[model samples]
Target: MRVIAGTAKGRALKAVPGTNTRPTTDKVKEAIFSMIGPYFDGGLALDLFAGTGGLGIEALSRGIDRAIFIDMDRISVDIVKHNVTAANVAERAEIYRNEAGRALKALEKRGSAFSLIFLDPPYRMKEMDALMLDLAERGLVEDGAKVVVEHDADHVYPETAGAFEQLKYARYGDTAVTIYRYNPVRSEHPMEE
Candidate 1:
């Protein structure tokens, strides 16, 4: 796959050497950016369950100041490193090989807050609800921060996950993309899906 836009636009990214990791398709990636942002000014980003660091790297290329990428697989981590280096954005990225829960806890301990958080865990995991709540409780997300979740098309998420409210949702083939924005104050009417 390749970066669809920004500074690293058009750069080809290498996939992790096995079927263990599913790379986001360029079409869906382009769609996601179109829906959330065609570009960004600057902000810190977190890519949990990062696979080859494509989403985080794309965010960096699109003007995110810095990004922390986390993945549990060694091969995926290596692939991410390679992709980051190839993009010449190593200085703006932190790549780590760790499980999602542990990484979230560490980020929480650091008292980190992200402007953008990408969640693309394995389809079978079904941990999005719990993870989103944990992120909210830990204050890991900035107020008005954007959280993007990618999952199997059949998987349905809540209209609101903790303080984050669903802003948009779309399906592309077998994949579904859900975008949420952190808003502690609730409105009289929740947004319709």
Candidate 2:
């Protein structure tokens, strides 16, 4: 895959060696970033299940202040590191070799918060629901922060998870991108409104 925009535009990125990782396709990536637009200004990003760190790297390229990439596999972690370094965005990245849930918990313990959190776990893991719940319980998402989940189009998330409100879903062939947001002061509430 390759960096699609910003400072690192057109730069090539290495992928995880095995089929264990499902890197976001260039078309879907472009669509995603286009939807999110230029709001990445100095925002903090978390890329869970970060195979080659492409999503996080894209955020960094678009001016995100920092991005934390989490992946359990050693090889994937290495590739992510290499890609980050190659993209010249290593200064704004933190690579973590840990399971997605554990990494989020650890970030919570460290009092870390992110404005944009990207979840792109393996298709069959069925971990998105629990992860989104945990993020809400731990307050990892700041007020008005956005959470974009990438999964097979058939995979459906709960209508509400704690403070997060599922805003919309976009389908790109076999992949679906679900966008969520947290609004602390919204009287409507996720479930009740």
Candidate 3:
């Protein structure tokens, strides 16, 4: 797949050879960025369960200050590193060869917070809720930061989780994109105390 916009626009990215990973389509990427708009300037980003690193790379190309990509598969991590270097955004990127949950915990320990977080795990994994809860508990997402999750359209997500509020959801064939934002004020006073 190719980057849809920004500095790396039109650049080709290498994809994983097997079906273990699913790269986001150009159309979906375009739609996602369109929804995100131009607010990414200098923002920190995180890519969970990152496959080819396409989504995170797109954020970097669009002017995000830095991005951290996490993926457990060695092939996927290598592909992401190669793609980042090829796109000339390696200086603004970091890759971690670890599972999503462990990576999130480690990032929390580092006291790193992201303005944007992308979650695109395998369709049948059903790990989205657990990951979201962990992120909430660990404070990995900055206040007002947006989290975009890609899942099978048929999958159901929790209505709410801690500080995160579901902003919008859209369907593209079998895939569904859900956007969430962390609101500390609301979460800190659940009963308006």
Candidate 4:
């Protein structure tokens, strides 16, 4: 895989050394950025299930000030670190090998709110709703933050997840990507598909 845009546009990223982790394909990644942002202005990003740190690294490259990448597997974490360094974005990244739940708790304690959150958990796990609720309840996401979720096209998440409202949804074969915006103000807007 490679950085598709921004400062690290062509930088190559190494995948996790096994079949357990699936890296986001360039096509889907491009589509995701198109939905939320093809670029950003200086905000923090969180990659809760960082397979190769691609999403978070992409965020950083596109202008996010900093990013935190968390993955449960050791090999994934190591690859994320190496990829971050290779992209020359190590200074703006924080990578850790921790499960989603624990990592959120620790991020809560650290007191950093993210403006962008990427959740691309394994297809078999259906915890996106719960995880979104956790982020809202813990104030881990800043108001107006955008969350990008990648999942099986057959599985549909709710129109709303806690403080986030669905903004966009698109399907590419078996993979589906949804974008949500944190609207603590409870504003109304039509969901796009």
Best by lDDT: 4
For TM-score, candidate 2 versus 3, the one ahead is: 3
Task: Output the TM-score of candidate 3.
Answer: 0.94
Q: Cα deviation in Å at residue 112, candidate 4?
A: 1.2
Ranked by lDDT, the better of candidates 1 and 2 is: 1
In candidate 3, which residue ranges exceed 4 Å CA deviation?
190-193
Runs of candidate 4 exceeding 4 Å displacement: 187-193
- Give the per-residue Cα lDDT of candidate 1 at 97: 92
> Mind giving the per-residue lDDT tens digits that candidate 1 earns over 68-121?
999999989999999999887899999999998889889999988999999999
- List the candidate 2 regions with Cα displacement exceeding 4 Å: 187-193
lDDT of 3 by residue, 1-193 (tens): 9987789888999999998898999889888888876446688999988899999999999989999999999999999999999888999999999977778779989999889999999999776767877887887878888888999999977767777888888899999998888888998888987
lDDT by residue (tens digit), candidate 4, 1-193 = 9999999999999988778888899999999998888899999999999999999999999999999999999889999999999999999999999989999889899898999999999999877988998998888989999999999999999998766889999999999998999987664434532
In model 1, what are the clashing residue pairs, if there are any?
A: none
Cα RMSD of all models vs. native, in order, equals: 2.6, 2.0, 1.6, 3.0
lDDT of 2: 0.87
Q: Which portions of model 1 miss their true places by more than 4 Å? A: 187-193
Write the residue-wise lDDT of candidate 2 on 106-153 in tens digits: 998999988999999889877786787788788788888888899999
RMSD of 4: 3.0
